[model samples]
Target: MNVALIPFDTAAPSDGSGVRRALRRLPLRDVLQLAVVAKVEGTATLNDVSRELASERIGAELQRAGSPALRRRSLQILSVGCEGITTPGGWLIASLKAPAGRGFGLALGHARSAPVAMHDRATRKHIGSAATAVRAAMRRAGLDRKAVELVLIKSPIRLAGGGPHVGSTAASRGAAALGAALALGDIYESDLRDGSLCTDWRLHGFRAMAFSGTETDCCEALVMGNRRGGDPLLRVERAVLSDILDAAPLAALAAGAKAIFFKAGIGRSGAVRGARTTVLTSELPPDKQLRAAASGVVGAILGTTRAFISGGAEHQAPPGACLAAVIRAAD
Candidate 1:
C-alpha cells in the first residue's frame, strides 16, 4: 500500500485555497476526506473551531458534497504544548483523532492567551495541563482510555504580535517529546525539571512539530486509531520515517501499488524544526481511496488528517523534513 503525507497551513489563504482547488482539479471520482488545522487569533478551544466551521457553512458544504460532518470519536491518547506571544501572552497546543471512513481525521489546534504568562519555559507543564483537559473531554464524550495510540505536542517560542520566529524552536521540540511521553503514559515530574522535554531527541514513535506566526492561543491534540472496529470498506498501511527526505522517493515508488492506505509522519531535531515531513496517497481520489489514505495517516502519526498539503510543508514541516505517499490497498 502507498500513502502520501501532504502538509498545509489553514491559516494561510493560499494553502486552504490550494486544497479546495485541488478537489476541483482532481478527478473527483474517489472518496475525499478532509482534515483542517487553523492557528486562530485569540483564545479558541477545539469546540470553538468546530463551532466556527460548523457555523460558517463549511460543515454544510461537506454534507452537501456527501462528506461526513464533524463527529468526535473515543479518546485514545493526548498531547499538549504551549508557546509565548506578545498580545495573546501564551498559546496552547492539542491534537485529537476522530473516526473518518476507514482511518481517522486528526485535528490540531492553536489557542492564543487572554493575557497569561507568555514567556514561561513550562511548556511540558502546559502540555500536561492540556492532556488533563482532554481526558475530561473524553469522559464527557464517553470514550475509553485503552483506545489511545499516542499523543503529540507542538511548541513554539515567544514572538511579537503572535507570529513565527526562531525563539520558540527549542520550546516546541521539548513540548513534542513531553506530549509523546505523556500520551504513551510514561511522564514523570523529574522529566519536567530540567526542561528536558524539548531537548531530548531520542524520543520517537509519536510525531510532533511547531511553527511561528500562528493566529490562536490554544493548543490542539488529535487521537488516531482503529477503535471504530474494522472496515470491510477499506484497509490501511503506515510507514514511519527516521528521515523526512527519504519519504518522497519511498512514496513515488509506492505509487500505483496495491494498498488501500498510505500515511507518514514529520518531526524535527535540535531546537530547529526538522526538514522531513510525512505524506499519504491513494490509488485514486474522492472515494475509499482518499478516506483510507486519511485514516492511515491519522492512525500512523496521531496528528490532523484533513489538512491541505501546501501549508503543511511551509508551516508544519521544517525546511527539509517531509513525508509523502501513494495508497493502494484492498477494498
Candidate 2:
C-alpha cells in the first residue's frame, strides 16, 4: 500500500476556513509536486481540533471523518504521543491498503439500510444492504470469498423520533453481521429472512467483527485476510472465545502476531464468566462501556495497553460469546 505523508498543521482558525481557502488556491503543479512524498508520516500541532469542531457545530463532520478512516485504513493514528505533563499538539497518520499481495488489505465501502424501526426489526432490512458494502471491500482487496479472514464493520445506527433510542445500535450491528455472514458463506442466504436477525443467534459470520455507531449513515467495512504470495511483512490470525474469561486462545494467537484485536460478547445477563460487569449496571451506554472493559482486560492480559476491542456479540461467535485476532509481521 502506498502511504502519503502530508504534514498538516491542525492549528488553524475557526471552521478551518483559512486553511481550506489556502488549499484551494494552491497551483495544480505545486499540489502535484507534494504528491510525490509518500511512505510514513508524522505529527503536527492540533492546538484545539476539538474546540474548533465544537465551535463550528461540526462534531458530526469530525466523527464522520474519523469513523470512515478507521473503517477503511489499516492503520490510522491521531496522537500527541506523549505524557500529559506538557504535550499540546499531535499527528494525523492515515495509511491506505492496496490489492494483490502488496500490503495489508483494507477497503472502504458503503451501503444503505432502512432506518426508524426498533431493534432487530430494522436490522432485518439492514441484512441485504450491508452485504453490498462487504462485497465491494472484498473486490477491492482482490480476495475471493475464501481468502477473506476478518471483517471489521461499523454499521450505521438508526435514530428514533430524531433521538437516541435504546438498543438501536444493536439493531444495526445485527443487520451488518447477518450481511457479512451471507457474503462469507458462514450462513446461507436462504436461511435468512424477516425475524432472522437477533432472533437467530445461531446465524453469524465466524470471521466478521461488527459494531454500530451513531456517526455513519451507511455500512463501512475493513476486510483483512491472507493472500497467497502476499507480502511477508504481515500475517493474520483469529480465535473464537468460549467465554469472556477465556483468554488462553487469545494469548496463543498473540504469540504468533505482532498486533491483536478483540471482540467480546456482552452476555445477556450483563456479566463476564458469571461475575457481573459494571457495563450493564452503569448509566454509560453498553457499547462505550464494553469498549473500555474489554480493552482493559485484553490489554492487561497481553501486557500491551493499546489493544483494539470492538464491542458486540450478536451472532459474532457462539451464543453469548465472541472472538479474538492478531496481525503479525513476518519474522
Candidate 3:
C-alpha cells in the first residue's frame, strides 16, 4: 500500500486545495481511502460545517481526477478535531503496483452505506447497514475475518437539521463498532438491538476504530490487512491497550512504523487501571480529553505528534483502554 500525508496549511478543508495536491502524489485510480483531520476553530456550534464541506470537496476532486475507483465511491472520512499536538491534515492511502518481492503486503478496500435517516441513527437499521458495508469491504479487500487487521469507520453524529442529539456521537460510534463486530463474527446478530449500542460493553469490535462526525449521514467502512500479491514493503499490526498508559505494547509495535492511529475509550466505568479518573466529569468534552491524553502518550512513544488519534471509543476498546494500529515496513 502507498500512503501520503498532505497538510492543509491554514486552508479550510472545504477549499479542496490540499486534496487536489494530494491527488498528484498518488496514483488516483489506485486510491481506496481518504481521511480529513482538521483542527477545531471557534465555538463548535451548529454553524460548524467543516465536515460536510470537506466531504463534498474531496469527492469533487476525486471525480475530477478521473479515478475509476470512484465507480464504487471510495471511502472518505472527514473528521474535524485536532486536539493536543495532533496536526490538521489529510491522508491518502492507496494501492499501487507492487514491485517484485515475496512478502505479505498491505491491502485496503472500502464500502459506503446508503444515507441513514434521522430515526435510524443508532437503531438496528443503522447497525445492519454498517454490518453489510463492512462485509462488503472485507470481500473487496479479499480478506477473511481473521486476516483483517483493522477496520476504520466513519459514522454520522449529527441530526438532519444540524447539531447533535444527546449522546448521538457516542451512540453512533458504538453502533458502528458493534456492526463491525457482527460482520467479523466477534459478536452475534441476536445480541444486537437499538438499546445494545453504548450500553453493552461486552459487544465490541476487536479490530474496529470508529469515528463519529458531521461529515455525512452515511456510514463509510475501510478495511486493511495483509494479502499476497500486494505491495510487499508494508505491513500493519494491531493491539489493545489496557489503558492510555499501556505503553509497553506501543513501544514494541512502533519500531519502523510509518503511520499510527489510535482509538481511546473511557470504558463503562470512569476508572483507569483501578484508579478513578475524572475525564468523565471534566467540563471539557470527554472525547477531546481522551484524544489529547492519548496523543501525548502515543507521541511520547513514537517521537512524533503526527499520529492520528481519535476519541469516542465506545465498543471499540476495553474499559478505560485504547486501540492502536501501526503500519510499518515488512521485516
Candidate 4:
C-alpha cells in the first residue's frame, strides 16, 4: 500500500481545527485516515499549547464546529517538537526551524573558555541538575528502581547568533545520560564528578534527544514503565539499531505489507548528516515475529550504514549502533 506525507499548518488552532481546515483543502477523500497531526511554533511549548487549548475551551469550540462524525470519532494526541511526529496512519510530519536556527552545539557554551571546555562545563551542570531531579522524582513516586523502563530527556540547544539550533548538545546529552543512570541507581555524584557519567557507552541505557525550538526554559523528562497498569491504551516499544545498512532490511521487516509507523535519528557521533530512509506500510502484518524482525533489521541497518553513521558511541549506543523503532500497540 502507498502512504503519503501531507504537510498542514498546526499553529492556527489548538484543538486540531487548523488540521481540519487543511484536510478540507486537500483533494483526498474526506474519510481518509489521518496518521498524524503536528503543530509548529516559533515560540510555543507543546504542553503549553495543549494546556492552552483546554484552558481556553478551544477544544469545545473545535468540537462544536467539527463534523458530527469527526466529533464522535475517537482521537489520540501525540506530540514532538523539532524531532517530528509519526502517526498510526502511516504518516510522518517533520518540523524544521528557519535557516537561522541550524547549527551544532548552538545552545551550549562556556561562560569564559574554549568551545571544548564550554561543552564540558555545560555537560557537567546539566547532568548534575537532571540527576538530582530524577532521584527526587523516583523517590516521590515510590517506583521500583528497575521498573523504570527508561528515562527520556528533552533539552534546548544553543543556536547560532545567540538563537537556538534544532538539535541536541553536549550539555543536554550529558544530562540525558546522567539522568538515566541516576534513575536506574547506577551512578553517584562522585561517579559523575569523576567523568564516569557518560564516558562509557556500555552503560547507555536510556534515550535522549534535544530539540532547540522548545519554548520552555527548563528541561523536561518522562519516566516510562513496562508494566501493564496505569494507561492501558498507551503502548510503547524501544529498539536499537546495530547497523546503518540494516535500514532497508528493517524497513522491509517493519512494513511486512502492514500499516506501521516509525521515527529515526542519529547520535552525536554520527556523520555530518546521517542518511535515513523510512517506510510506512499500509497493512498490519500477521504477527509480532515479522514485525519485530522488520523493525530490528531497519534499525540495525540505519545504525551501521555508512550513510547514517555517527562516531559518538562513548555515551550513546555502540560505535555503529543507534535507535530506530517506537511501536505503539494499536488501541
Candidate 5:
C-alpha cells in the first residue's frame, strides 16, 4: 500500500486558493485519498478551511479539487477538524492507494443520519442508510455482503442530553451497526424492534466496528472485503472478546496489522473489573475518558499511539467488553 501525507500551512486561505495551494504540494493522479485534519489555533477556524475545500473536484492533473473528484470514478472525502490553541489551522491530506494488482477491488459509500419512525417509534435512520451504503459499496466492488470482512461506522452523537438525546452516543453506534448488519445478514429485521437497539446484547453484528460522537450529524461507513479474484495487498482480521481484559484474541488477530480499530463499553455500573470508575461518577466526561482508556490499552500492544480507538462499544461486542480488528500488510 502507498500512503502519502501532506500538511498544509496555517496561513493558507480557505477560499479556492487554499485547495489550489494544497494541490501544488502533490500530484493528483498519484493521490487517492484526501483526509483534511485542521487543528484550530487561536481564533482561527479549521472548519473554515474544511468548508473551503468542500467544493473542489479534479478535472485533470494540476486541477484543484475540493472532493468527490473523478478518479476512475468519484471519490469520497473525510474532513476532520480539531479545534485547539497551538495546532495549525490546516490539513494533513493523505494519499492512499492499494498495492498494484489486477484482482484488487475496493468500495466506498455513505448515507446521512436521520431518525426514522419505525414500528410507530422514532429511531436512528442510520439503519436504512447504512444498508444502502454497504450494499452500494459491495456492488461497486463486485463483491457480496458475505465477502465483506470489515467495516468502520462513524456517527455524530449529542454529548449532553436532557431527555430524547440521552444515550445518544450509544444510539448513534447502535443504529450504524444495525444498518451494516442488515446488509450482511448478521442480524435479522425481526430482531430490530423499538427496544431492540442498544438493548439486546444477543443481537450483535460481527465485523461491524461502530463509533459515535459529537463530531458528525449523520452516519458514515467504510467497508472492506476480500474477493477471490483479488490478491489484495491489505489484510483485515477480526476478534470478538468476552470482556475488555480479554487479550487472547487481540494477540491472534492483530499480529501484523498496520492499524487497529476497536470498541469498549464503559461498564453499565461505571466500573471495570469490579473497580469503581468515573465514566459517569466524576466531573470528567465519560466520552473523553473512554477515548483515553481505549488508546492507552491499544497503544500498549501496537507500540504506536495512533489507532482507531473509540467508545460506544454497546452491541459491538459482549456487554462491558470490546471488539477488535486489524489492518495489515497482505499475506
Candidate 6:
C-alpha cells in the first residue's frame, strides 16, 4: 500500500489553483480514497464560497485524471475552516493498495452515500444512509469490523435557500457518527432513532470522526485500518481526549507521526473538565473556539501547526472530549 499527503498553500478565497497543483501529483488509478482539509477565511456563519469552489475543482480534477471513484465510490471530503493558529493550507491524502502482503499495512476503502434531503438531515434516514456507505467502504478496504481503525465522514448539513440550518450541523454530524458506529458494530441499529441525535451523548463511535459542510449533498466515508496483507511501512493509532485540556495522550502519540487528524468538541456540558467555559456564550462561534484552542494544544505537542484539526465532533467522541489519530512509520 502507498499513502500520500500533498500539502499546498492557497492564497485566495475559493481558490482551486493549490488543489489543482496537489492533484497533479496524484495518479489516475488504484487510489482507494482522497480527502482534503482546508483552511477557510469564512467561519460557519456564512456560506463559504471558496470551499464550494475548491470542492468542485477537486471533483473536476479527479474526473480529468480518469479516476472512476468520483461520486460513486471515492470518499472525497473538503473540510473548510482554519481559526486561530491553524494554517491556511490543506492536505491532499490518497491511499493506494495492492493484494499481496505478509504483514499488516494501511488499508483504505471509500464510498459515497445517496444524496440526503434537507428534511432527513438529522433523521434515522441519514443514519441508515451513512451506515450503508461505511459498510461498503469497509468491504472495499478488505477490513472487518475489528480491523477498521477509523471512519472519517464528510456529511452534509441541512440547507435552507443556500444557507445553513441554524443548529443542524451538529445533528448531521451526530447522525453520521451513529451510522458509523452501527456499521462497525460499536452500536446496534436499535440504539438509534430520530431522537437519539445530539441528545444521546452516550452513543458514539470511538473511531469515527465526522465533519459537516455545505459543499456536499451526500455523505462520504473513508474506512481506514491495518490489513494483514496490506502495506507495512505505515500504521495508525487513535486515542480519545478526556477534554480539550487533555494533552498527555496526544503527546505520546506524536512521537514519529507523519500526519495527524483531530476532531474537537466543546462537550455537552459546555465546560472543560467541569470548569465553566465561555465558548458557548462568547460572541465567537463555538466551533471556531474549539478548533483554535484545540489546534494550539495539539500543535504544541506535535511541534507543528500543520495538523488537520476540525470542529463539531458530535457523536464522534464523548461530549467535551476530542478524538485524535496519527499515521506514523511502522517499527
Per residue, candidate 4 scores C-alpha lDDT tens digits across 200-291 of 44455434322222233334444333332222322334455564344543453342121122223333343323653222222521112222
lDDT of 1 by residue, 43-71 (tens): 22222242233223323433444334321
**Worst-scoring 10-residue span by lDDT in model 2:** 32-41
TM agreement with the true structure for every prediction: 0.43, 0.65, 0.87, 0.44, 0.68, 0.90
* Residue 298, model 4, lDDT: 37
The TM-score measured for candidate 5 stands at 0.68
lDDT (tens digit, per residue) of candidate 3 on 4-65: 44444336656777767877776655555554444432223335676666667777877787
| Candidate of highest TM-score | 6
TM-score of candidate 1 versus the correct structure, residues matched by position: 0.43
lDDT of 6 at 106: 78
How far in Å is the alpha carbon of 183 misplaced in model 3?
A: 0.5
Give one clash count per candidate, in the order shown.
85, 1, 0, 35, 5, 4
Runs in model 5 deviating more than 4 A are: 1-27, 30-124, 156-163, 213-217, 274-276
Stretches off by above 4 angstroms in model 3 are 1-11, 29-47, 67-73, 97-102, 158-167
Rank by TM-score, highest first: 6, 3, 5, 2, 4, 1
Model 6 residue 169 lDDT score? 76
Each model's lDDT comes to 0.31, 0.53, 0.73, 0.35, 0.54, 0.77
CA RMSD, predictions in order: 13.2, 8.9, 3.3, 15.3, 6.6, 2.8
In model 6, the clashing pairs are 14-50, 105-231, 267-319, 267-320
What would you estimate as the lDDT of candidate 5?
Answer: 0.54
